[model samples]
Target chain A: MEHLLTEDLLCNQLQHSTKQLYRTGMVAQISLAISKPVSQQFACTLRVGEVGVLLAPSGAGKTSLFNAIAGINQASGFLKIGEHDTEQIELATYKRNIAYVTQTPVLFGHLSVGALLDVVSAQQARPFDIKWALEPLKLDTILHMRTLSLSGGQRQRLALLLAMIKGATLLLLDEVLTGQDPSTKLACITVIKTYLKRNQAAALIACHQLEDALALADIAFLQQQRAGIKQWQVMPISNGIHAYQQSLLNDCADTAQDQQTVCASAFLSVLHATTISHDPQLGLCEYRVAGQPCFSAYSPHISAKQSVLLVLRANRVAISKSLLPESSFVNQWQAKIVSIRPVSCQGEHGMLIDVTLVNQGALTTSQQDVVSVWITRLSYNQLHPKIGESWYLISKADAVSLSCLN
Target chain B: MSETDLQAIILTLQLASLTTVCLLLVCVPCAYFLARSRSVVKPFIETIVTLPLVLPPTVMGYYFLVLFSPNDGLGLWLRNVLGIELVFSFSGIWLVSMIYSLPFTFRPLQSAFEQLPKDLHHAAALLGFSPMKQFHLVILPAIKPALFAATTLSFAHTIGEFGAILMIGGNIPGETQVLSLALFDHVESFNSQAAEQLALLMLIFSFVVVFACQWWQTQSSQNGYVVNNHVEGL
Candidate 1:
């Protein structure tokens, strides 16, 4: 909530600049008749250092929007940088200021990483550090490797570097980085976030990762239907970002007090495994969401190839910096803290730490993986966990339970 | 090889070289248009361009002969006004070879142009690559195998020409008599040894061309590039 207010204040501070050059050098305008006419008309004013996220599935008009903004597709729209619309300006010439890293990266096949960087770097009028760009991507050692030979993640990082070196004012990234390790994802996100903040630039990241959307986005442009027509509505995620997760809200309820649904903190999301294996000796049903924390529950009804949503009590889930080896706990998953707030559990001061599961398959039908891990205020202070810091979510296998979903 | 046969082979190489270079210059843009344009005449244009692949060479030659005969109005106008002649000359064979082997070039180039994902073009545009620059940097390299196949096939096809060049640009010594015509003359004259030697050369050239094309396609595909980033399009 505090972050959202600061964001509003930040926007207001940068709003009244016309004559004096502003921090965010240019203001981008997207007014047009799109291919997906009604669906693509999402608008909001963004300042430098402000990041907006477009949360939608693939094939949901995300790339269409990116194409329209980049002036690649034949759409009737005004793409303006600063006061003059780009359409009125030289629209036919390739506009170097717009950096669009598509999901399927199209790189110059023959050029090595160092050569690509050197070429794009020479085109820039402003100063840019190639080492700084390569630092977060961890691509310094692979400078001689050809762009065509790089992996998907490597291509994404290189695209970002080229964008930075070329000085793109409005960075439009289409889920370029995915399937990275927890630390790597954080590093990539930090690189982008810091670049935007320092340059006084704005970005719109199209992502399916909730943590990415929540952690970096000042505003969430969501897909919704109004009067049977699809449109975009800007939902400010400054305060209570988790409440924006649809499943966390009870459809039957209407109040902010009931915003966190009854089942919100109850279920844990397991993305990959189709079947759950039962350990007879421990009497536990084990399922693994690949690259995410594992879950084990004492149940017999859950069978192989079953998609079951395990029930996790708020108190049973524990957060720690390291694995709790002393306790007989087996179910553990790595997650990063999103937000922490004071709450009263059993008439005691407790911290409701919101931890989001980190992975490419972090998406869920319901806000299941992102649940509250209740810890006493003393433990929270002693551990000193902050937002974006990784921590383990653990529960004793014997204490866990599961309910099968049809 | 005799002096006459040597002259014929030299003329054939010159014609094939000129035709291949000119045809590629025309086909690259035509194939690009065929792959991407949505104009109303696109279907008609595509059919006309690809006709040489399926049409009999003699039938195609017959049409060209009728169209470009100096007696015809359009042919006479080009000759008198532009100082250009297209019938019974080296220039005529060059033009005829270009038309007859067009499909050999256009089909592969067109297929390569079509095989590329549209996203790459957009990425090139955002990266500030001009149309020609985009073609050089992105489109050309990506379609190298097809380009190789198209150029070699067109050259080989023009070299082995018979029916079309014979009909439109009749075998005039030193001007239009190509290798294929010399071989025919050798065989018809019952010079079995000369015909055998010429046939062996043509056979070796065709084999090398085919082998090179196959090697290029395999090399391009196995260039250690893996793109797993699948972005769904709307």
Candidate 2:
């Protein structure tokens, strides 16, 4: 009885989610220092409930970063998880709720998956229902098979399930989803997003799917600029790439949205939010924009609390005189007409107009918010959406894509 | 074969068994350390362990004689304190045989351990298996073939030892005259038939030992696990 009570108390103290902590507000910030000389020193912080993506070329120390935190590599630096500093805890007794899933499967070939799963589940302080845990990733069929017999995708999923089974509060993925197919990717991300939402946890995903993966990250660390500051730079993806990715995101609403610090060079679509979640069945993922409820494309497979970028393509957006109830466009937003600049596209005979559309989410900033929507000059002349006048910005669901940055 | 030769063969078996057992307990730890240790002095210790493999048996016998001779400090200490006489005795030959067979047992075990992947150790260590448990669960099972080879080679080497035992035990019949020494005596005398018979016996014993080891090695290389009283490819 005493032993069980002690274990419970330890779990509670180490747990990050509590009613008091939620009320008071807590940050699941992971501040780690990579063991290197001052010349190559790398240390970064990821806030609680935020998913940061580490982007780098092969052998740019991405896995090294994960290895340092997992205590697998030789490292000497401060590693703090939640409220517990690893330096203060006895290594023999300290059981961290952080799980690092590597790209290659680390398995005992002789042991069956079910046997290993039982061991991992028993090790956890509070185990989730095994059936519920295994169903999302389709791990039920593999329970009796030897791990060696599983294929690469099956092994990766099983490894991920094993990690999640331990009730890890912080997940470290080292390119675990680089080469997976679309459905497997969706299933994996769905499981991850749901778990993060349920537990209020954070994750650091190191990925090779650089552009495609950017849609899911709250803050992406590309590379540390060698300038005097030696800081990470937020480089931009191409306009076509961004628009297409956003369209894909809106179709899928594949991630959550949260307030995170990002720098400028290319990635400019960022919104400040406390937390966000997506619904896959309803085909809608929702999050707050400037403390007001906002809705975007409905993604039937998206998990709640996913990062999403609301993207409006300049070509597909139209300026309207009034809210058109009969318009086939699914997304309609009310914004003040800031300016209408005459522009030409591809030397076309028709005149094109760049209409500056602003929303309530853009109102919070003292700096003038700039949101642009394209309209044909003939349509603009007929409707004549005046400057400083309220007008509806209407676009089709296909025109709006959930950008990854926001 | 003569009654004396038969006694000599039995004596050789007993000596080989005793030497192989002692060498295993001593060499296993020595070989394990040599395989795993990263110390700067590891090479020098390894050289010492393998010295018996390269050094002449007579030269080793000369050193052993000087160390355990009755007048020597070690010999005096043994006789006075423990009253264990070693000179020209079965114990004397057994001790000499262990030194002669050290490399035969040590090298295989060292190589077997070195060939194991570092990830195996890393995985087992983080899983909270103690060093003793690691030996029993992981290390021992993986190196069973090497252990068997080492034991068989050590036993055979001790049985065939002639030069070192001659120097240490001085060929006292029924005391230190083993198979090889007894065969050597017949060769030195004019008894060609007896020498031929004893040589043929040693050759047949060696052939059978080598053949059995090879067959087991081949089988182990094939499917690994084998059941006794069973046919293959069933």
Candidate 3:
């Protein structure tokens, strides 16, 4: 049998009808077939040790799905974890051999950090080397301290480390990086990636940071709601963030009110770029995207030739018929409008115009540097921007958010 | 104090001590079940545990007295098979005390267990601890103060028991007679001095129990032992 976890769980959000009776609040159907050792296929199935990220707005049943998979919550479904058929055998949570790190690290408070580590080491068949993470996660100094005395980030780091060391084939991490600083968050991400690769273990990490989640995930699972039912859909992320964002835009329109964050992310384009120049004195950095220069505020962390992801909000992108005199808009690109379509987002009507860089060669979908601009109904009527027309797009330096690619 | 009064005092201490031990042994499992079990009959079982708290001790003793009568089926079976005699004996009163003080010992433990971090057991299980180990290492240690509270309250409550002991054990010298019965006998015979002395001793003992429980809770809070168990729900 394949080392895989498959579930078609039906979960309900229950509310108390009176003091004793509970009425069904909402129902969600979570069906996923995740394979160990990461398989590469169409978006139909996720090859999971390559790491999958579960993305949804709050209360989309991400944690509920994790609980179901961990055998903590009972849901009616055809559930299987590796050789154990959960539907046939009532497997205990620990018996499932799945490591679950909840939002708050559930730790033994009575035990010291060292004692906790000792217990985990003694119990696990193959313990992950805590020494490898001691320095980076800053857990070395706190090893002798009691777990109850540790800060939020320290607790999260320890929890993740222990879960990895438990040597479970699957890891369910729910917002494990919430309390960490930027450097620590990067360290945790690196540590998680290293552990997964080294152990050939699959992880379904639920995080709200789209860039970080996408950077770490081979494929993304979007918990989408259609009509009254919510479902988990395998979202292909091979074409980078643009294709994924575009897919969200296309599929999440109907549920815009419930998925405000998803809709907000859909209205932005994430471009992969490399830094060309940085002037710390002037606090400005120039990046090359699709063979064009894009300028943004400087950061000490971003050096020349370092790859980065630039987030450009569609509404901030302004297009003109001709090149105009720049005031504070430091970045400008000459492009040809490829498609113009009317769209309603968050109950507001707008026109989404897709533009491609001028003079670019025949590019595949993955290589296409398409910048989407959202113009309101008033601006659409005023500009009368037509498809296949050449235009100049202007954006302020601050409008572009520079995120370092991991 | 007279020799009979001394014998009654000794017997009361022995009864309270033995009854408290038995209550702890029995109530730990009962409190654990009441705290964690989701069975359909949980409410019914909870009601039974609480019955001793609300009903008059004489009423509880009357039921047990009927149950332990030699003419009754259960009492006859015990006498025939085990050669055990419970009525008007030390064992009879000790058993009654355990039942009478059940809620005093069990309620605090149940509340503490209920207030325990919900995921503590789950965390222990995932860490490969057996269920027994989880209880010994995680659950017991977390509720140590409550354990102390339960033991002291049950001991104190058993010491104060009078009506149930009278109904079951009767007033017999050095066998089933206890301090409460001696004090009652002294007051009825117009021996005001001995009765006053026994009443004063009982008052001081009750004060000590309340002070010990309050002090234990304060110490536990100061040491952060109880604070650590109060993890916010996820």
What are the lDDT scores of the predictions, listed in order?
0.68, 0.62, 0.71
How do all the candidates rank in terms of lDDT, highest first? 3, 1, 2
Interface DockQ of each model: 0.27, 0.11, 0.44
Worst 10 contiguous positions by lDDT, candidate 3 chain B: B225-234
DockQ of 2: 0.11
Over the stretch A186-225, how does candidate 1's per-residue lDDT look in tens digits? 6777888878866656788787665556556666776654
Deviating ranges (above 4 Å) for candidate 2: A1-30, A37-52, A73-77, A82-98, A103-170, A179-202, A211-299, A302-406, B1-24, B81-85, B126-136, B172-177, B182-234
For candidate 3, write residues B1-45 as lDDT tens digits: 899989998998999899888888988988888899899998888
Give a tens-digit lDDT track for model 2, residues B85-173: 77788999998898889888888788777766555554443333346655766567656666777787888888889999999899988
lDDT of 2 by residue, A252-356 (tens): 232343122211112223333323666667665565544435556764544555544455445666667677788676556666775555542223222233333
Q: Could you give candidate 3's per-residue lDDT for residues A30-101 as a string of tens digits?
A: 243322222111112222255677766566677776766676666443333322212312567766657788
Report the C-alpha displacement of residue A241, candidate 3, in angstroms.
Answer: 5.5
**Model 2 chain A: lowest-lDDT 10 consecutive positions:** A258-267
